[model samples]
Every structure is written in C-alpha cells, then in structure tokens.
Target chain A: MKCGYSYDELTAYFDGELPREEQSKLRQHLGCCGECASALEELRFVRSAVLSAWQAEIQAPEDLRSNVLGRLREEGAFRESLPVKTPVATGKGWKGFKGWGAAAAASALLVAGASWAWLAGNVDNAPLNTALIENKPAITEHIPPDKEVKEVTEKEPDGTAGGSATDNQPGDKPGIKNQGTAVTSPEKPGTPRQTDNAPQQTATGAIALKDYTGKAFLSVDKKSYSGYFQLTDNWRNYDSLDQKIKLTAAGYNAALAGSFKDSGGVVTINVPTASYNALYEDLKGLLSAGGIVKGSDTTVESIESQYKVVQTELEKVREEYEASAGDMEKQNQLANRQNSLIDQMEDLEQRARISTIAIKL
Target chain B: MGDLKTDVLIERCRQGSEAAFSELIQIYQNRVYTICFQLTGNSEDAKDLAQETFIRLYGALPGFRGQSAFTTWLYRIIHNLWANELRKRKNKQTISLNAPIHTEEGEIDRTPADEKSNPEQLIEAGEERKLIWTAIDTLNQEQRTVLVLRELHGYSYEEIARGLGWSPGTVKSRLNRARLHLKEQLLKLGVKPDKESQKDADIRKKVKQL
Candidate 1:
C-alpha cells in the first residue's frame, strides 16, 4: 500500500522474488506512482548498463599465452622431478606404484646427516662448566672499570661510599675537601699504581696482552675526541648507537672487502681512541651535571664510547690486514669471531651515520 | 566422454601433451580472458589472473572428477583465482577509475555503416556503455561476478550458483540486487526509462521470483 517498500520486498520485486499475487500488486503500484515508476525505470537502466559493461570487449596480450605455456612447462618439469605414481601392468591388472625409492632414501640420509650435525654443533656450543668456573675469579675481579671509577670518585671522608654531606665534617671546605677526597683518599697510592699495571686480559682469555693499548684491535684517536663527541652526540640525539655501530662496521668491511668502492673516500671509519676518550669526557661531564643519573643513560654512554674506540681500532687493523691477506685466506677466515665483531661494528656505525639528517637553512 | 574430440584433448592434456594444452587454451582463452577482464576491470590484471586460472586448472585437472561440465569446473577455478586476486589488491590505495577502451587489434568494431543509423547516436551509445561499465565496477566482487556470469557469459542461474558455491536463492537475490544497483546508476547518468524497458524489467523480476 505504501510507496516506500521494505528492502526485502524491493529486492523481491527486482529479483522476481515476489509471488504472482505480489508481482501484480507491485506492477499496479508502478503503473500509478510516478516516483515508484521512475525508481523501477532507473533500476532497469542500471542493470542494462552493468550487462553491457560486462560484455565489453577484452583481449590478453600477445606474449601472455606463451608465458602461460612456458610457466606450465616449468611446472611440468618440476612435477616430473618429484617421485610420481606410475601405473604398472601385471597379470591381475594395472597397479599404481611410486618410483624413486633410491632418491627418497638419499634425501632422507642427507636430512638425517644435516640434523645430526646441527645437534652436535649445539652440544659443542653448550656453555662449558669449566670455563664458567675459570671465569668466576676474573668476573669478580672485573669491577666494571666505569663503576670502580665512579665508586672511588664519589666516596665520602667517613669511608662510606654513598650519598653523604661533607658540610657535616668540621674544618672541611665543601668543594676542596670533596675534590681531594674524590681524587686521592680512597685509592691508596700503591693501589692506583697496581691497577695501572694489572695484566691485560685477552677477550677469549687464552691470550694475554703485554701492552693493552698497542695490542688493542680498536683504538680511538685522542685528537679526534671533540669530533667523535659531536658525532656520537649527533648519533645519540638523532640515531641509535647500536644501529650506527652496525652500519659503520658494514660500510667499513664492504669498503675494505673491496665489495664497495668508496667514491667519497669517506669509509665512515669508527671513532678512534682519542675521539672515544673525548666522548668519555663528555659522558663524565654529563654525569657530573647529573644528566647521566639514570642507570641506562650511564651504561649506554659508557658502552657506546668503549665500543666506538674498539670498533675504530679494529677496522684499522682489518683494513691493513686485508691489504696483506690473500683473497682466498680472507674468504676462509670470514667466519672468524674477531672479523665478525669488526663487521658488526661497521654495520652499526653505517646505520647510525645514515640516520643523521642535516637541515639546511 | 561422448564428445570424443574434447575428451581426447582433455585426456592428452592430462597426459602432459603440450600441444593439446595449447589447443585447449586457444579454444577457451577468449571466454576466460573476458570473464577475468569483467571481474578485474583491467586488461593487464585480467591477463595475469587468466593465466593463473589456467595454471591452477591445469594442475588440478588430474584430480577433476567428471561430476560437472569441464567448462563449469574451469569457470569455478577462474572465479576462485579472481576472487583471491581481488582480495590481495583490496589494500592498494590507488585505483584508476576510468574503464579501459579497447584500442588493440580485435577491439569490438562499433562503426555502423548504415547512414540512417546516425553516427552521433552510436557515439552517444558508446559513451553510455562506458558510463554503465564504470558503474558496474563499483559492485562488490560477488555481485559483480554473478552479474557478469549471468549477462556476459549467459550462464544459467543454476550453473552460476554451482560455480560460485552459492545457493540458487542467493544467486537470484544477488543478481537482482546487482541489476537494481546498476539501474539506479544508469538513471544517474540521465538515461530515460520507458514503458517497454519497464515491461522487460517486470518480466525479469517475475523470472527471478520463480
């Protein structure tokens, strides 16, 4: 009776979903109401348009058929290579049997061998109990050099090593007494001297460094300390140290490895010892200013500085060594841990460097 | 099995006969390509989709049970592949709205030689066709597929339902809705409806209702 019909009824009218009685009623309504009539007309036009559009001419490219055939051939070849069920005729009837038993056996053997090797490798790398026992003393003695320095510098005159006021002590000038105590008292003269000559431990503990500075694979350039600080600061503010170190090591090795020729002659080498020290001083300044109060902040700055120095020196050695080493020998030594570390550092530095964007005024 | 020629070709193709496969492709290529083009609204996408359809069909041929017509099965495969491709490209932010006018060698010749048939009228009709196609592209994939199969390919409702794995009622309803949507679009394009068109529409509505 109403002009506006339910969607279901409209759909039925459109789709012939109505019964004969309803269809006649709908038609009677369409014949009378201009709006419903117009709606039905519009619906017809839309349907015809869709139908014509659906019938529009189309053709595949000339090469498409050939390409499809070629792909099919490739798939066929691959299928042929796989073990296939073949029909074999016997006195009874045709029976289906799979062939390539030998090939399957060979494949299984190879998989088994690879799995065994992987398991053996994992077992060999299992943390050695002996090494852990051996490392106990060294680990205890290895007071994180930074923490030791901080503990010594922050000590109070009462011999307590935490937060305490020097103003409480009679006859003590705040700045002078604090500085004197920080620089001299806690470290006995002999203790400082002994620490300076403490044996340089090799990274793997099997080798010893007669001269830690000289034997160091990585050394930051002291002269470039200011530049290194700026670079690292730029890196920290805009980029990540891990990413920079990774990228730098990657670029360095890629250049040194001759896989990439440096057009700008900027190999993006790591921060040298001097630069690292400068960064260290910057960190210390930050610490002194209370900017490095957070544990993460202090640890990140110190580690970043140390890693920069080590990475720079290592790259230099690698570049020099690469020049003298035979190509085959270098290839063979590609899996060496030392080389891997150098590569990792270069990669980090490269990533860090790229992340630094300059804004032009 | 009664159609020996087709049966032999199918058997040969199943047995890895390249020539047989090529022959089959040639025979069915246009229909399949047209179906793909209608579904995808682009020639390049249609070609790739058609090729993939054939590849899948060929791979699955060995397992095809003769429960349905071979062409029916092929249509089902093409439809499924096109559906997947549509889903894949759904996330792409950019889409060209203009329907491609066939300019290549085998384009449908719209030129009417009879002078009485006005060239202006033919041109108007062509433009109308283009608008209609553009509107068709707006339909959802299933609605579009059902409409195309019914109108362009002239597949029976049962065949379409079987191919698309929808109930007969679903096919009928979807086709009706799709047509109605298209009709509304055509009215927007300023096509005037007449009594004759209304009567034809009435008959179609009646057929669907049955």
Candidate 2:
C-alpha cells in the first residue's frame, strides 16, 4: 500500500470514523509528519472555534410549546390530548389571542408598512446588532446598500408586509456603544443599521468603529472575499490598471504579491488576501471603463480532503509494516509509504493557504 | 430522559403518549432550539420551526423503528425543514440575516449592552467569539448545516451523512469548506489566536463581556 491515503479517510479519521488499523497508521504518520499534523490542528481549531462561536445560543420562546400545541390542536395533527388542556390561541406569542392581539397585529402591520416606506431609501446603515436569547451577544454585519437589495425593495409594492433587513425598531441602535465619533446614524432616517463596523482605538481611551459597506452578504457564498476567485477583467486599461493596483496595494499596505503579463493583455498576479479587496475594486472600475469581469471558484475543502486521502493511504502502509515487523521487504515498503504520503500532504496544505487569480486581456 | 429514560420516552412517544412527547420537548428543548435558531437565525422562525419539528415528530414517531437514535431522527426532521425553508426564503429573496433574534427581554442586540465589567483581555476574547459567530452565520447553508451538526451537535460523520442524505465524503468536504471559511473570517477579524486551545467558557465569558 502507498503511504498516501485519500482525503476522505483523513477527515473520517478526525471524526473517529476510521477502523482501528487505519486510525493507528494515520496516527503514526501524523506523529511523524508536520503537514498532516498542521492539517489536523487547523481542522480541530476551525471546528472548535466555529462551534464555540455557535455558543451564541438562543432558547425557543417560552410560549413556543403552547403555540405549536395550539396549532396542533387546531389542525388535529395529534390524537393524544394534553395533560393540561390550556386554551388555544391563534395570535403569535399569545398577544394575538387576546383582544389586544388584533390591535398589536395592526400596529405591527402599520410598522411594517411604514418601514417599507422608510426602507426604500434606508434601514441598513447602522450595522444591526441584536442581543440573542440567554445573553448570547451576536452582531450582524450591516448589509451594504447594493443594487440587488435596492432594486428588489424598489420593485416591491408599497405596504408589502415583511420584516425589514434592519429588524430593530426605528431609531433604536441597540448594539452600538459609541466611544467616539462613530458613523452609527444613517445619512437619513429609516435606514437599517447594517454597516460593517470596523473598530479603532481612540486616543481618549475609547473604542470607536466605523461602518463601511452599506450592507454585507448574508452567506459565505455571497461574501465578496470568501472564495478562491479566478477573476477576469477586460484589460482595456491593463497597463494603467496594473499600475493603479500597485498603487492601491501600497496605499492599503497590501502586496501585489506576484504577477505575470503577456502580450494578449492577459495578466495573472497573486494578490495578498489583505489587498485583494482594493485590487478587486480597481479591476471592476477598469472593466467599467469598458470591459467585462468574470470569476471562477475553488473550494479549500477539496484540497483538504485530498490530503486526507494521502494521509490515510500512508497509514495503511504503516499498518502493513507493523503487522510484519521483521520482514525486510515490509520494512522497506513502510519507509517508502511514509515518504510518499508526507510529500503528498505538504502539497495539499500549501494549496489550501494560497488563492490563485487568473486575469486575461 | 437522562439515560434509560430516554428510551422509555421514545417508546411512549412512539405509542402516541402526549405526556412523553411533552417530556421529550422539555428535556431536549435547548438542543432543538439551539439547532433551529442557529439554522434560521431568527427567533420567530425558530420557534415556528421548533414547533413544526415536534409536531412532525409526533406524526412520524410511530414509524420510528429504533433504527437510529431519537435525537438523530428529530434533528433530521429539523434539518429537512430548516433547509427547505431556507430554499424557499432564498427563492423568494426574503431571507435576511437582518432579522433580530427575539428574546424574553424583548429584542436585544447580539452585542451586549454593557462590557464595562470585562477587563481588556476579556474584551479581546469576546470580540474573537463574536467574530467567529458572525463568520459562522455567514457560512453558506450547506456548509453551515454540516458544521452545526458536527461541531456543535457532536454528530458523527456517518450520522451527519445519514441525516443530511449525503455521502459521508460529502459531509467531510462541507465541514472542511466551512472550517476554512471560518478560518478566513477569523483571519479577517485580526484574531490570530496562539495555537493553544481555549475553553468554550472563557470564550463565552469574554463574549458576554463584549
């Protein structure tokens, strides 16, 4: 067996899904190999950090059980009767069940109506930060006032009832505590607090954050900087744009990293993650100056799993050698397997850290 | 149910016992709500989803042949519902991370109101925690779902695969993507944690301070 294993096996090993023999060998390789060890460490850290972050836990509303039970009662989804046959209510949060429910619903609808009126031009400027249930503090990035949302909001008819992007009540900036001249308020009223808050330390021992983007994306897939992007832009001003990006990088303390140019107006460069945003904008402006921009995507998961496969294969070889301790051929086979898998893992790890960009003229 | 009682409750629920069903809800409410809220990111929708999950479980309980653990089955239902709702909301373009999670204390911001109690170190920790969550919530649904199931719910790879109706390989890959995405978000947050392991409480306390 080759020392290399498939990425799936390595992932499974991390999840404790591998058989004992396979696990033992992978452990052996992991102990000997820095790349695999690092991969494992990263895997664990991401998982732990993410899950711990998930600790911004929220409990279901106290009335949830009743609401569901009432709905079931109304719909007759269950035949079993409850021990306590509490009165059923149709309104949300029991507020609606009372006669006041109508008034509350009307008020809510009114607010929704007014919000749509205000939201057309505003509602996402303050970086909406809502406290979660059970004291879990969660801050949502302000959704930038991009065209898609603006267009969508514009196309919708008036008094369309739904929650606005800024779910907080108007003028209630619940999360932000100003220590300086922070940009918390919208340029005008009725904007949702959805700006990306970047905090800076002030000279007066206070922390202030500025809201940058009008709104941020809701998912990683939609996020501007989330993927390994293959960006393509019309190189109409390829020369000047290239120079502009260099300047932009310098301005942002970002590196252009590396670039390859050809006569066909094709240029490829490694943009440091920090400076990629600025360069990307510059690319967009050049394209707008009369060109097109396109990008392809690659996921890091693919590379990590591939490394795991190599790690797993290597482990199998070590197991084979361990089972046949004194066999010279087997000992030699184990050594060969270890060498092969170690190299494979390092390659995958390197690929995981680097993002590739290919630009054409 | 603590241990053996869980099995008994399952039996009762399977037999159409409302008491047992209510018991199940009481016991697992936190777990169920946690998953639901994490997926939906809205307290209102989460409540509705949680109720719907239990109601569905009530109907599906009789078919529960004990092939898998009850929690797994319940979570499967939750995952299916949450995913479907996400797709529907996405299709309608109505989904927004903008919705504030409602709590008993009215709508509170994800950022704590007062961090004056927290010292500087604690504040840094809180900021890191917040950064992590913001990243996690921003994760694409597929990857986010796999991550919540594995990392937070402690589901085995095979179990998650079975629950999601995907191959175990798919589960691992999604988790990888989710983790890397998380790492990137954290990197952007300027939180370069030393390669040492930190306890969840420390993270939580720090976050609370924020």
Candidate 3:
C-alpha cells in the first residue's frame, strides 16, 4: 500500500484501469511522491524487459509434430467415431423407443415386411426357386439331380412331394421356414438362377447361394461404403441384436465382417459390392429418424486404384534402393517409404473387401 | 489464420483429414510452444506439453463447434493440461529429492541445471531482460500465468477470467498481485532501471546538461 491506496489500486492505476476520478487523484499524488512514481515506472520497465526477450517466436520441435501425426494415423480405424446425430427419415417412426429396442423393433418390421412381400409374389411355385433356397450349394445332397425343375414345379400342388421330401432332410434349418427363404427371393423378372452372382435392383432380390466363406472371389466383388446408423435400442437387447445380426447376415449370405466390440452397438457386415445399394436400402428400413448420423459411398475400383498407385510407388522406391545399394542413408529412406506404402496397401486391401455398414444399434 | 481458412481446416479435421490437422499444427505450433515454454521453463517439458496439446486437439476436434475462436479453445486446453501437470508435480514434490525424474526418454538424474547460477548464460542477455525472465521463473504458477497472459499476450482481464474460469474481480486482484510480486522479484534480482528505462536516462542527460 502507498499514498493511502492499496497495491490493487496502484496496479489498476498503472494499467489505466482505475476509474477516471481515482486515476486523476493517483496521478496528482504521483507528482509529489517519488515512491509512487518509481513504482509505476518499475512496472513499465518490467513489462518492456519481459516483452523484449520473448517477443521473438519460438519454434516447436519438429519431432513433436511427427509424433502427433503418427499417433493419429496409428489410431486410424479404431478411433471413436464422430457423434453424428443426423436424423434418418425412416427412423422417425420409432422415435418413442431408445437404443437397441428401437433397432430390434425396426428389424422385426423388416422381417415381417420381407415375408409379406415374398408371400405376395406368384413365383412361390417355381422349382428353380426351390433349388436356390432348399438345395443351397451346401445342401445339394438333399435334392435328386435327375428330377427336372419343371416336374418339381408341377408337384407343388400336391404339397407331399417337394415339402415332405425336404422336411426330413436335416438341411431344413428351423428359421428356413418358407418366409425366411422367400423373403430374400428375387423380385425382378430374371430367372432365379441368375440371382446367385449378378447384382440385382433390390437389396432382397439377390440371395447368397454359396455360404459367404466358401469361395475366394478373384475379382473386386464389393464396393466400400460406411454408415452411422442408430437404433434406439438399449443395452439389454445387445445379445438378442447380436444374434439377430448374425442370423440376418446368414439369411442374406452377407458376411458378418465386424465384431461386437463397442457396447454391442456397432455391427459391421460385408455384402457383395453388387448388393451394396440393396443392403443400404434394406438398412434405411430399419433405422429411425435421427438414427442415420452419416452415410458415405466409395467404389471398390477407387480403393484398388489407390492401392495400385501405392504399389507402383513402392516398386519405384525398391528400384531406387537396389540402385543405391552403397548409400546407407538412401537405402534407409527407401526402406521407410516401402514400409509406409505396404501399410497403406494392407489397409486398402481390407477396405476393398469389406463394405462397412456401421449399424450403431 | 483468416476465419474462413480456419473454418475450412477445422471442418476438414472433423472429417478426419490428417493433412488439414497437420496444417493447423504448422500454423499454431510456435505460439503453443511459446506458451508452454514460458509456463514450464524447460525445452523438454515444453515439447511434451505442445505434443500433448495437438494430440488432444485431434481427439477433441469433433466436439469443437466453433463456439469460441480456435486460439481461445486451444489456450483452454493448454491451461487445463498445465493445471493437471501442476497437480502431478505437487504430488511428486512429496517424494524424496533423490528420486529419479521420470521423463519420456527414461529416468533422468534429479540434478536440474541452475539457470541463474551460470554466469555465461546470464551474460548472453541484457541484464534487465535476464532479470525479468529469472523473476518470472521464480514466481508462483498463478502469478506467472496471469502476468504472462495480461502483460505479454495483451489479454484483457475479462478474457483471462473467462478463459481461466475465474471471476472478473479475481482476475483484477490476481493481476495486481502478480505485478507486485514480479516487481519485488525484479528488485531482489538487483535490476537497476537507469539503463533499462529510456525516460530515466533522458532525464539524467538533461539534468547533466543543466
């Protein structure tokens, strides 16, 4: 304290922060009092001296930048997804239900809607359809190869021949009730056999004839797409939803590509890129409004092309490494370039095969 | 640094664009490092704090809704992290002095370099400037923080209060106390202002001429 004023008052005066009247009084006191005057000057000198040394910019270490970027890249796929809360148009109906309950309800609706659509179709009597469903590539042992499809079709009226014969075959899984198999039946005019490999107009139109794990596809058979879908289902439904997702993927022959890692909400599955649009349409029917946080699509070709570009660069670097064998530094740089390219290629390869549909149930 | 560019970069970062985030680091790294250095008074810890700041920014990009300026949000992270570090240091202070310092590289010896005791480093700067830095280094965390923000960064009392989550009255008092503490430290360091204060030198010259 000085001149009957607290240090706060003097500091405020030094900063021009004292009220106009009090500032004038302090200024008057300072003229007669050397102590108050020097205190104010000392404040000014301290500020100037600190500013002089530190005003120059200080560069952060270069490795700090790399370490941050490297850590982010390392966490690339497993990073927590952004909380995207965009309302989905279809999810609006289940607005009352929360979390997994909403998802189960929506999926239940999908099962019923699919069953109704199948029962309404006249293709029920088609023998070739029976071959695709009852005698799936896995269950070929049950169907007699000599029986003509037309003859099998004609026996549908009797109900005794085809139904009774297949009933005793262990191939008839309990859920394979005609409704489950027929729900995924092709809706287009194409013959049922053609639905096995070709992309169809509807998500339910193409059915997986071969078990998902049976054959290694030689070509890029899937596109890459991701979605943030919310199901107002709660934690209690996690097990049931987990089982249903597996069954649903099996029903459609889509591979359950993702794990139930995060609170049982995120379910990732791989459908043939040909069936990508169809599966996307199928999910839109299951989620509620505000359920779809985001959806994005990218082509398998694009991912492959990116992989190819990285491969080409890797090859170029390899050639450089081979040519500069005597130079250790250049070789070290080439090795690092190769390692990063390999990492990128591996990531793209996995992405090309999996069309990630992140159903946040 | 323009609002439009920052917004674009922020949006890209939210969308998981590493390139844009790297660019943001480039733009603010120096400023962030400077603040960290000023607070910690050591290059190694400053680097660690700056790296931690960017990594936290990356994780938190999704939550940033542009409610405040990017720098303001960035400073808040630094402030919070520093507070945590201070708490951790306070806990460690209870340990024996001979306990090894656990750093990222490994455990280092506890024999910290005495910056003031070295005459060669002190002589590298003008005496007043050196004294100011030494005084700042000796001040408590709150005083140093308030002094650096209010004086060096030109932040208003209200801005400091809002950023630090203190009341305006608290900011006023803290800044006042910080200045006086700093003044006392400078005087203790034997900082004579005749050479430092241009006004005092000018007055002395006129008095001599008269």
* Fnat for each model: 0.31, 0.40, 0.37
Root-mean-square deviation (CA) per prediction = 28.6, 26.5, 22.5
Model 3 C-alpha lDDT per residue in residues A318-338, reported as the tens digit of each score: 999999989999898888778
By DockQ rank, best first, the candidates go 2, 3, 1
Per-candidate TM-scores read 0.41, 0.43, 0.45
lDDT of 3 at B103: 25
Q: Which candidate is the best by TM-score?
A: 3
Model 2 ranges off by over 4 Å: A1-10, A17-22, A55-57, A77-87, A91-361, B1-23, B65-68, B83-125, B194-210
Model 2: how far residue A166 lies from native, Å: 49
The clash tally of candidate 2 reads 45
Give per-residue CA lDDT, model 2, range B90-181, as digits (tens): 42243354554343234533332233243234337455665565556557767778887676666788777656567877778888788778
Clashes of each: 43, 45, 16
Q: Which wins on DockQ, candidate 1 or candidate 2?
A: 2
Q: Write the per-residue lDDT of candidate 1 for residues A209-266, one digit (tens) a residue.
A: 1111222212222111111111221111111222222113223433133311311222
| lDDT string, candidate 3, B1-210, tens digits | 338888898877755555788788888898888788776655766776787678667655544656567787777777656654554343223434454543222343443234346434444435445555656665566666777767666667777775555678987877777777777766666654545444433433332221
Q: Candidates' lDDT values, in order?
A: 0.40, 0.45, 0.46
DockQ-better candidate, 1 vs 3: 3
> Which is superior by TM-score, 1 or 3?
3
Model 2 Cα RMSD, Å? 26.5
